[model samples]
Target: MFSSVVAVCIACFLAYIFNQRSREQAGDKNGKPIPGPPSLPILGNLCDIPKSHSWFRFKEWTDHYGPIVRFKIGASEHVIIAEEKIANDLLRERGSHYSSRVFLPMAAEYLSGNMRPLFMPYNDLWRTSRKLMHRLTMPSMANSYQPAQSIESARLLHDLLQDPRNYERWLQRYSGGLIFRIVYGKRVQTGEENYLQRAIKVVHNVERIASPGSYLVDVLPFLRYVPYPLAPFKQEGMRLHSEELDLFRSLLDDARKELETPDVLKRPSFAQTFLEEQEAIGLTFDQGAYVLGSLFEAGTGTTAAAMMSFLLTMTLHPQWQEFLWAELDAVVGDRMPDFEDIPRLPRVRAVIKEVLRWRPVTAGGAPHTLTKDDEYNGFKFAAGTTFHPVQWAIHLDPVLYPDPDQFDPSRWLDPSFPTYKRPLDKFPTLQNFSAFGFGRRICPGMNIAERSLYILTARIAWACKISKAKDSQGVIIDVPSYDYTSGFNVMPKNFAFNLSPRSKLHEQVVEERYRYANNLIYLKPKL
Candidate 1:
């Protein structure tokens, strides 16, 4: 009986391999194969996928192959869209078939409980979540959040002035605090807050689990069905999910309690609105909690990462600081920048755009799955084909951006560059920007994010000068241009840098503004 069982198991394994090979051999109906590096049997390009900086690898593959390159891992077909035009063509114009996300067994199933709209499949739940986010983050509503953004920007400047070495931490606090207030009707005054730390933990956990090839189960679906005794990842994921759920629920409960208070003038929040209309919105308590948590998760880290990248850029290229100062000094001398000044400050806007283009936080871009068979150019792809509109490649495309490797804000400022456009007021905007993503799945919080970047970048530039740090020997420490943390959103690895107030006036202004903002009625409450 043992011998017979072993024979049967071996036969089944062989049959599975044969089946996968058969599918691979089956050419597209059009007889034009999508170009890619040749794959090995069974593994099928699995070994070729990089565990870190996958976007750079994807760019190389796309350059060697065509813009639309295809490769297989197990039975899955993955396509990389290198060109912005092609990405826009399929992921945007034909969004109906390409908006869905590829499922990850570890991240989406066990960790997220299929509740994170960012990773959820295109379905009723996703639609409902998207609608809620859209309602909260529309341009008009985003504009309403500017007062909060401004206050936080002032706090950011104050934090940097007090402790410049921990600028990264302060940036994280700024983004976390802003999103926490917007999502839960509470405040995160410092990075040391317990709730803020909990939220940051959640973001870090998700980034780790969701990173491509983080777990074997993500690529091999069958591993997810393994028994608990053999699958420790399953246990870890469930524990994380439970912890995240509790935190989200607690935040929602707090929001509910605040709303119950009568005659209290409170800043409006997404959680407050959701709790008030939960029944009408048709989401359960858990679903609503995750939706709000998702917003906080999405907003916090990426914004901080972008801001950090901005600091890195400034440290490496201090010449741009003079250009920004020129604009700021001419437009609103001796005063900190406000939203009103954004229209007149094209250089500030261009710098933000250029930073996003230069080193996008989500360098790989999110994966989109095709819902039905589709043909692009001459190649045909079947339903469930995964597509990655690689931001690393698209942003660095030489045709669209000359001297693609150079960090040139002039691309947006000067008309000589191909990316340049007329009418500076609106042309350098982040609307429909490739970094925020494409199609129906595009980030809904882009309005809030753009505003945050603008205000924070402008304030930092106005108040201080960033430069390379000097060691005990008084030699400037070199900063690596491409050394970044590996994850869904990448930030520059810790590097030596110095930040100081440009003048005594700038220091005094930051102090006065922070104190004045704190005295406001809305800012008085810790919550």
Candidate 2:
């Protein structure tokens, strides 16, 4: 209750300050600034931006005002690209100029010590960090991690068979475990395990703090100067910062110690890899630790959320499940699906693409900043302007995707749509404006994320029957199209669904694969 009051007070205070500031003429008559909602004195549409699910509202604005729309909130200038072509032109074609990140005071500065790679501005440090991460997540190197991904996914299938009710938790664990194990060489068997808990807490702290419009300190940098006694957010930031330092630093130390043990070969961990090239890469201890944390956070939450969306789509649209199952049974038979089977399972790939488009994990996108003044379609865009590649709008564009709201995997299967083709062996192409972001700032973990989704969803389709849950009255529960939790990455709210083994033979195959998968997890450590 007190936090709510504080947040309201902060918003009111910020609004008052915004009211006092004079609005600037953003562009000349010949090439006026992009059209947006009319601004009030200093507030400049600050209050117009919704506190939750702003992506939907931004999409609405684009629908009304056209592809490119501009808005000002306090001192910040924003240009939202709703169309893919414009997003591609600016965010992809002109990525060199738009790759830098906007200043994040509360999220990136105090909480993260300005070290979180996702929030870092484009610079030598960011470049070096990016290179280090590329060594692990690059397509050529990503194949090495497939064995772990496969085993972890198989374990997820086994868990689902045992306890389908907690399917959400199992998916979360799978995503968290795979990334955590890959990064720290520590497994997350359960949600409450020490490694998973610490990693999740660190990520939650940053997400809560970093969300746009969450902290007044982010809007008005001077508030950070307030004394610790009065500034509760600062105090919280300090506590989280201390916790992060202790947790990540200790993990780094442990990895170092483990590598030095007698007869112990170095583990396949980002920490060990980073340590090996630490001097060559010119990164400090803190940089390496934060990189791991960033990878785990990005890889886990988004992947888990997308998987959740997939389950929800299946439950809501069970008619398609039969089609998917038919495809799975014909192509994969009774065995668990693997990366090698991706080519044969075009329907599964189409379903994954549709799910990503229907509910993008990064709906509002990680905000990118303009480094210099630029013009787009006769509109003047000043430097330092924040551009949001609003996925909700882009994916729903009528021209690009007909009947965008409908969960139709057939769109990808159709020959007319060239961009909808299933990724052949390699992961989903990040070249276009499909999810995983765009341009230089596209997800480095795209290879792993796509592969994880494919392997898990394909296995689920092969092994289980997904259908809408029914009540005592034998009536299917109605699921609203957009019933979802609100956040930077929007996801489906908890919903009831029936998931059971497709057949005894399928279950047996799943069991055998689960047992076989153990070899990947146990054997890798020995070597």
Candidate 3:
């Protein structure tokens, strides 16, 4: 019986491959095939896809094959968009047809139970989730969370002043605490908090499982149907799903309990709003829990990673730090910077924009699946084609950004550069920034992320001096400009750096502000 079953599976796999090949041979009406590297029979481009840092390889392909390139792995076809205008033309101007996501059997099904909005297809459920997220994260609504963000920023300054060696930990705590407060009406006081650690683990797991070629079952979907005991990946996915669900449900339950108390001094949170309007929003309890959980997951690490890149940039290009300090001293004087000061501080804003464009957190753009057949520039693509608007390629395009590898903030500040725009205040802003993403599926948390980046960047520049570390010999240590971790979202690896207060008075102000923030009624308590 087992032999017969094995024989049948092989037959089915062969038949599927043959059918796919036949469809490819039948040319589209236009008969203009997309350009790409050569592929072999049966395996297609499976051997070409790297297990890590695939973005660099994709950029190389774009360089050789023009802006739009196509390759196949197994039966699936993938396209890479390397130019900014073409990405905008398809993913934004024609978003309705290119907004859906590719289906990953492990990450989307077993691990997430189809509840992770990032992996969901462009269907009613995804639409509902996006609508609910927009309610809390839109620009107008995002402003309501500034007080919480300010409180967390104060803590960040204090943490760095106390222990500058663990600057990465402090950044993680700041982003985690702010997101937790906005999502569950709770605060993450330290980096070791149980909830924060668990959430970080969950995010890491999802990124690992969802990465291209991470799991064989993702390409060969039939493997998912094997018996649970025989399939280790299936068992692992199920275990992770249960743990993630428990975490989400527990956080939601705690928020619900807090809302039931009349004298709780209600702090506004996504959890509270969702619980109150879950019925009206047309999502079940589980769906709402995942929506809130998704917010926490998406917002936590990406912001912290970008901030890490900022620190790395400051270390590498200390000249920019002087530019930032000059702006902050002029616009923000002695007090810590806030949102109202953002418009007047163009250099500070420019530094943030340059950091994002220089080392984008998501170097490989998020994949968008074509929901219907489409033609662009006389080339035809069938429905179900996956598109990756490679951020690494577009941001480093030599034509759009001359001397693309150089860390230059002047591109946004000077009229001589092609990227420059007039009225520095509005031009250097993060709105519609390429790093945040494109189209209808652009990051909903962009407003919050931008605000966090601005406040942190400004305050840090005002209070601290960022420089390269010195050894006992008083020699400056070297920091690798391109050394980054391997993941969909990457950060600079731990490097030696010196973060110190600019003056004794600056340290005192950080302490005072932290104390004042602590006294606020909305700042206490944890879920």
Question: How close is every model to the real structure, measured as TM-score?
Answer: 0.95, 0.92, 0.95
The worst-scoring run of ten residues by lDDT in candidate 1 lies at 518-527
lDDT of each: 0.86, 0.79, 0.86
lDDT of 1: 0.86
Instruction: Write model 3 residue lDDT over 1-527, tens digit each, in one string.
Output: 58547844774586477547635653466658788998765556778989888899999999999999988766777889998999999999999999999889899999999998999999999999999998878887778778888888999989887888898899989988888888888878778999888988898888788778888777766676677766778899999999999999999988899889888777767898888877899998888989888888778888999999999999999989889888888887778888889989888888888999999988998999998888899888878889999899999999998999998998999999998887876878899988989998898789999999999999988999999999999999999998987777888889889989988888888999999988775643222
lDDT order, best first, reads 1, 3, 2
Off by over 4 Å in 2: 1-26, 264-266, 418-433, 472-475, 519-527
For each of the candidates, the C-alpha root-mean-square deviation to the true structure, in angstroms, is 3.1, 3.5, 2.6
Off by over 4 Å in 3: 1-29, 261-265, 523-527
Instruction: Summarize candidate 2's per-residue lDDT along 364-438 as a digit string, tens digits.
Output: 877889898788778877677889888889898888888888888887777576455545433333334459888
Quality of model 3 by C-alpha lDDT: 0.86
Superposition error at 485 for model 3 (Å): 1.3
> Which RMSD does model 3 reach against the true structure?
2.6
* TM-score of predicted structure 3: 0.95
